[model samples]
Target: MNHAGPSPVPSIFPQFFAPGNGPTDFIVQDFAVVMIVAAMMMAITYKLKQPMVIGYILAGIVIGPFTPPFSLIKEADTLNVLAELGIIMLLFVIGTEFPMARLRTMGKISFAVAIVESTGTLLIVFFAAQALGFSFFDSLFLSLALSITSTVVTIKVLEDLGWIKSKSSTLVLGMLIVEDIFVVTALAVLQSFAAGGGEFSLPGLAVSLGVTGAFIAGVLVLGSRYIPRIIDRAGKTNDYALLLIVILGLAFGLSFLSTGIGLSSAIGAFLAGVLVAESNSAAVARILTLPLRDMFAAIFFVSIGALMNVSLVPMFIIPAAILILTSFASKLLIITGVLVRAKFDNVTALRAGFGMSTARGELSLVVVKGGQDVGAVSSTILPLLGVITVVTTFLAPYVIRFGNKITLTETKKSDGSSNMEESSSGVG
Candidate 1:
């Protein structure tokens, strides 16, 4: 038998970035692999009677370092870019499906529930952490981190279920917006406090607040008028009809602009969505983006799975459990408050609770990551947050599915009002 020298086999991670495969190209390859896997998992999850969001997240964990694949992942930065695009699209799509008038009509319930839920959740979470002997800062940040649910996720699940038109669904969206705004403010305040050696200056912090306020005012004031004309003009040609290039530019431009002024990029993206909401451009923007967003979003969820430090779960066992429990309860409380008073049956309220349970998509990650970049949280906190997010994301779907079944059975014929209109842009 001829002795063969050490066999050379291309490894999965490096094979992704080998010679002649540019980083962007390789990034695309890794992205494709992840999305395909996640998509397949989503199909399986649907068949197995779970939410697709949970399926996508479970796919991440299975191929993540925790399970069999124990896969070495790559192009994390590129995937992050794609994931953010998924979020922007998520928000923009929500905008297209629900008009401002509808959002406002749900006003009191949304306002009351969001106030009660978020404020109540934050207090319970913070006090609970302190009672458990975590450091003050740790408790504050942990509660802050855990209290807010992912808008990207809550909106997507509601959209897929066609519930945005319902009073409850609309209430959820309003709650999510309220949560996002709170988190942004908390992040800003935290960053300032951290920067100033654990002391907060109301006067100095106001500068940042004022800057953010101006950005919002400018966009809403100008965008409602200006964007409609741009959309009209751009609709003139196929290249222009898409008008995605302009959308992308403005979204990214505002993101960078916000960061320059000390707030996070996600704040910019949310504002961008709100701005885009004003014009007829919302529908046109969705039409231009369906194929691309669908493709990129799959990659994004996969990459999120890939970025997870599955290793941490083994070490932070008790803390992780508490965090997840606190998070789940907080969300359930918030969503329940919103749905219950809307006079939803106990089952529907629980289902709405389940739907809102997933935490940590675009904005939460932005808050935590921005905290780290600016020296707020300890390095250890990042892994902890990552693990918590991974667990919650996979959990939301199952909860939602269980909620959906009970809800559908009880109210299936009682209410036809909950089916939010689909995007002619192709929610199908």
Candidate 2:
């Protein structure tokens, strides 16, 4: 007591004494944890010859709130914001791959396949959802949710399977573009319906479509003219950083513009990419922005995984299982038939169908989330969708790989025709 209570104890960690707690610490910690876990899982999957997407999603599940261990993420909103950025960047990259000429070339067949497949999926899923006892609105929302395929996941799967340059791959990409357009239109109708403006508000729907069409036209006409000129001038400086900044600025600027007009930011970012791609600087810009696109894209998938609510899965197991099975089968059949009708060979049609069947990831998530936000979809649908997406995404790569193997065999058979010609010429 006389010695001042044996001296005051000094703590080893002094950073705690700095200031008031804020989001910075939480964000840093959460991000570090997510990245570390994701990296480790990715390594494990690589050793097993699996896609990195599975690892990223599993990493999210490990640290997510639904898991047994306590959640490590304290700033979910920050993660969401980053995920949104990832979406924009991903779409921007996709847009860069499609110039106006390419779009025009792919338009007819792509639109045919997309319209048939999407409409077929919607009708099938709608009736199936109703048979499963969902309400009219819920069935409508669910059908829409499952209609649009996940362009990101499908492309990743195709690339991983080494089929990215195949004829079917081209059709798949084209179909995705068509689906994106349909999704924009569907979202507008859904928003109107959710607001109690009736299921088919002629005036509202017309206005929405008109605005969207005008925006696209304007971007293609004006942006194609100006953006390339600006990028060319900027590229003359030969500064990689400056080129990247300009590209990103255009991407984000267009994304913001799209959102302001009630369209998806992804569409705008894509258009921006398309404009930039028309420029001579496209190659340089793609190379410079690749890393940023990849990094954020990983975060986006992880955030999707983090949103999974495992406990709710058991509540709708029967319906979810049915929906997944029927949705996959129907889409596969519909897409295959459409491709065949469009003059694609049997193997190519089947391959395209299989690839398209695995398209229930990001776009489905958007539809479901939009419905929930507007009170048109029930909270119960979230986990069901999460489970369906995970299952389909995990299976997609294998399915595509199998299809590729079959296509390769068909190619070899076709090559045999060349041998027949050679033999006939020698005999002659």
Candidate that would win on TM-score: 2
Tens digits of per-residue lDDT, candidate 1, 1-428, equal 11122222236445645666778785665566677788789789779765455566557655543344334334446655666666555444434444455456656766676667767777888898788777767677777777788876666666767766764566567777667667765666666565557665677667656766776667667766776567656655657535887776666776677667776666666566665655666677767756766665555555555545555556777787887888678778767766767776665576557666665665555565556656666545655666676677666655555555543322233556543221223222
Best of the candidates, lDDT: 2
* Clashing residue pairs in candidate 1 (N, C-alpha, C atoms within 3 angstroms): none
Once fitted onto the true fold, the runs of candidate 2 whose alpha carbons sit more than 4 angstroms away are: 1-19, 134-141, 188-199, 369-376, 404-428
Q: 17 in model 2: Cα distance from truth in Å? A: 9.5
lDDT by residue (tens digit), candidate 2, 310-408: 667788888888998888888899988877787767777887888788757776776775566467777678678877777777788877776655523
lDDT of each: 0.63, 0.75
TM-score, prediction 2: 0.83
Model 1, which residues run further than 4 Å from truth?
A: 1-29, 58-71, 74-103, 130-141, 150-170, 184-198, 238-242, 331-362, 379-383, 390-428
TM-score per model over all chains: 0.73, 0.83
